[model samples]
Target: MGNYQIIATAAMGLEALVAKEVRSLGYECEVENGKVIYSGDESAIARSNLWLRTADRIKIKVGEFKAYTFDELFEKTKALPWEKFLPEDAEFPVIGKSVKSKLFSVSDCQAIVKKAVVERMKKYYKRNSWFEENGAFYRIEIALLKDVATITIDASGQGLHKRGYRIDQGEAPLKETLAAALVMLTNWKADSPFIDPFCGSGTIPIEAAMIGQNIAPGFNREFVSEGWNWISSKVWDDARMEAEDLAKYDQPIDITGTDIDHRMVKIAQENAIEAGFADILQFKQMQVRDISTSKEYGVIVGNPPYGERLGEKKAVEQMYKEMGQAFGKLETWSIYILTSNEEFEQFYGKPATKKRKLFNGFIRTDLYQYWGKKPPRQNEMMK
Candidate 1:
């Protein structure tokens, strides 16, 4: 348990951000397609499961094999120690995903693995008893890629994006994972003010409040690893204790959110209260053109509606132009807007300093960032 390798799964285009998060957690990581691999001890795994904001889940790769056929898959899966993780009375089920492989039938592979696990457990326990049970302590997923299979034990049962605060979501709600990534992309600190002008459902402000207060994003939920037989109850207790200790920094951080829809503003207020950050954020109903910028320095990060469930293209363009007019007044504030519209820069009246690809679910979007400064010359010296 002292040495382990784990995968921090992330949304599709934010793999690099997930790697950065892993490294920030004081561990070395290798970035791969839609995932980051890192090494740590048991405690580090617990901490990462509790603290990582941009990841979808933390998975423990249990076994790997070159399984091109059902026999090979069964033999390989049966070789692992299944009884060590599952209790004697625990009811387990398997989920399988296969891609670009000879064993492409997902159901077939799933059935094979399930049979292997059951056989191994029966032999290990030396009992001929097997019964169907409704729930289990853990759920396992097997993924097969080009002639290779990897077995992963899910550490976080429900996706980490379900931070347990957003009970009411308006149409086209942005995921909590992407919202946190938007906050981090701003490179914001606790000293700076943060606001989301088009803040729908208050995802941006709640995530900002969590980040500014150094709160662990997973503190409000349960993990599948907590019920595993191999882990001691003391480990979870220590993890919770450490998370509770980390959440003590609750000073006001000047976080605010506003939306044009009064109903959305009320929902945002309710979400903030549910997340226990109502005191740290101010929610209001205001149009984008009426946004006031009294602060000299801050970050405006948000995901505006891009003609998807909101309105037509021309209307959205006009709305964006008004937003640009409002944001142009803040010369000292950096702006990061996530949108699927490529012509957004035309409305903003300035080229973006940087652009990163991000996905709002299946929709392709770009995070356009405008730093409030010009690029320094290559050979220029500091003053």
Candidate 2:
């Protein structure tokens, strides 16, 4: 296992959370706009791929350089030590994106990078003919932002959000990565009751259940890099074992999800069972306004409808007003709501304690937090 630069790409507005997750895994990282970068060996790659809950994907930073021309791009790309990562029969696909750069043609950039990598591989592997590419897959990317080219090989095959448990979902299902972020941002602890009123497909509750149990988001999935020869099977084995050992499977949690749609409730139940939390998580068909809980010091995190489509604004706003009326009475329960609607607080009847801007996919949204009063210390009570 050789030391290499690693990049954990995250959604916009989630770089800090991703960086925090990386650091918690015992690796130092620098948080960028949409990425957290660090250096680590194979174990770092494997562990990050398995443990990073908030990242979109883990990438191995191949090389970065300034490229103003096609020739410069090809030469600099070829100069990187591709042989160290790519085997003789590795299947390398070049995908590219160019932004505010002289190399404005993405297809040309990808083609040039591919040709350059092939040329480099031929020279290093001593091959006369073209590569058979019958072995491990290496999806390479060339990103040019302001004339700087950063190349990386994808380590997580599908996005990390594809936790492989969702057999069904609603029309607008929230990404698991974003769902986990919503849970992590709340004041809810494993011992406290957690609820998602508008839990479409039950993503929030399932993610909360996993978090409450200290389960690795990637524990049940496989990564693209797991097929690479350079990274030993033992590396992945060790990472999995570490995940297994660190999990709090026996921990008790009170998590619930309710949706207005009965079909969505059924789907959520199926997905939870698929995610191995059938008994740990509860789901039901319920409306937001009717949500009444006796549990104090709990947290309510919800991703309600943004009413972005036509004619839905009126109904959604009414629902929001009802949510305000319902949730406002629970003074001991903190509430967090994610919505793109700017008038959310106005309709919800109270201003947020604090607001954090976040993007749900491409839609700009804000997390409106209502902090609840803290629970009294045991000694503060009458003796």
Candidate 3:
């Protein structure tokens, strides 16, 4: 039940979304370049790991201080209360990264931090012999920016984006975190129709289904911190129970995913079934040109090929033109497209209502949004 400083790390350009998710989980946080800073008890650690859909991973901030030299780095790291987090048999591994700092050698920094922690642990636990290192893992990180060292311990073993659903994938698959973010950015309701026209391996549709049904992204996953000695097993159990209690399993959602490649469609179906949405999500092998629906006020989202490779721009742009023409008929349907093409609007034959810059794994892209007419309330419809 000890309180600690927590950090939920996010990918570039997604710090706000991660912060929003942290706030939704009842934690006050400050957004930084690529992480959200907050503080809470053991329950907060478990709960944040279970929630926070867009975060890369959850980390515990152990120490932060200035380090001008190797001795300064080692002494400062040794001075931190490492005994509070690591047990005598803790298998803690130090990973390091240096950016714009005097300690330019990452490997050197990692070695020094590891030695310092071992020294501190030896002093506290009265161990003359070397640590057997055969115990639960505690991955420690030493990140230096401008001579300031920030040390943290990873709580979420793997990244949170590893939702454990997509056993199969295509060549250029979208990350589950980014997929979830795309759905969150839209003005979509659970009851309305949702689609991903360029659904590669069915990531967007599966993510949308999870969000629509109010299911926690980590509902079906395990975290690293569950093995820690200090945190009670009941903390994780209670957090899981909360997730189960909050899920809207009975809520019906109209979600569809289609791709031009039949192989991709099959892969998408397999992934959707694996995600426990076998019956809820529909997948089809269809081209963007053939996409048409009579349903009004639905939402369309796509991460189409950006035509970054040589000699493919003309054909991709032609497809964009056809996609625009086909989608132009559904004036009531909002369209959200993610692409690196600067002239996406020009090719799509319509200006976006709003466009947002988003990074798709180092390839900068824009999320072009077209607002649809808001649907009337059920009571108004009855009237």
- Predicted structure with the largest lDDT when compared to the true one: 2
Question: Local error of candidate 1 at 194, Å?
Answer: 1.1
Shift in Å, residue 167, candidate 3: 1.1
Clashing pairs in 3: none
Q: Which stretches of candidate 2 lie over 4 Å from their true place?
A: 378-383
Candidate order by decreasing TM-score: 2, 3, 1
Count of clashing residue pairs in every prediction = 0, 0, 0
Writing each residue's lDDT as its tens digit, candidate 1 over 1-383 gives: 75666899999988888888888879999998888998887777788888899999998877888998899999999999776666677767789999899999999988999889988988988878784544455677889989899898788888889999997989889999999999988868878888898888999899988888889998988888877666677888898898788775756698889999999999999999999977778998998889877786788997988876545888888888998888888887889999999999998787898999889999999999988642255226544
Per-residue lDDT of model 3, residues 1-383, tens digit only:
79999999988889999999999999899999989999999999998988888999999999999999999999999999999999889999989899999999999999999999999999999988799989989999999999999999999999999999998999999999999999999989998899899998999999999999999999898999999998989999999999999999999999999999999999999998889999999999899999999999899999999998999999999999999999999988999999999999999999999999899999999999988776677438877
Report the poorest 10 consecutive residues by lDDT, candidate 2. Answer: 374-383
Tell me the tens digit of each residue's lDDT in model 2 across 1-383.
Answer: 68989999999999999999999988999988899999999999999998888899999999999999999999999999999999998999999999999999999999999999999999999888999899999999999999999999999999999999999999988999999999999888999998999988989999999889999999999999999999999999999999999999999999999999999999999999999999988898999999998999999999999999999999999999999999999999999999999999999999999999999999999999999978888336744
Q: What residue pairs are clashing in model 1? A: none
Candidate 2 backbone collisions, by pair: none
Off-target runs (Cα >4 Å) in candidate 3 are 376-383
Among these predicted structures, which one has the highest TM-score? 2
Q: In model 1, what lDDT does residue 153 have?
A: 79
Write down the lDDT of every candidate, Cα atoms only.
0.85, 0.94, 0.94
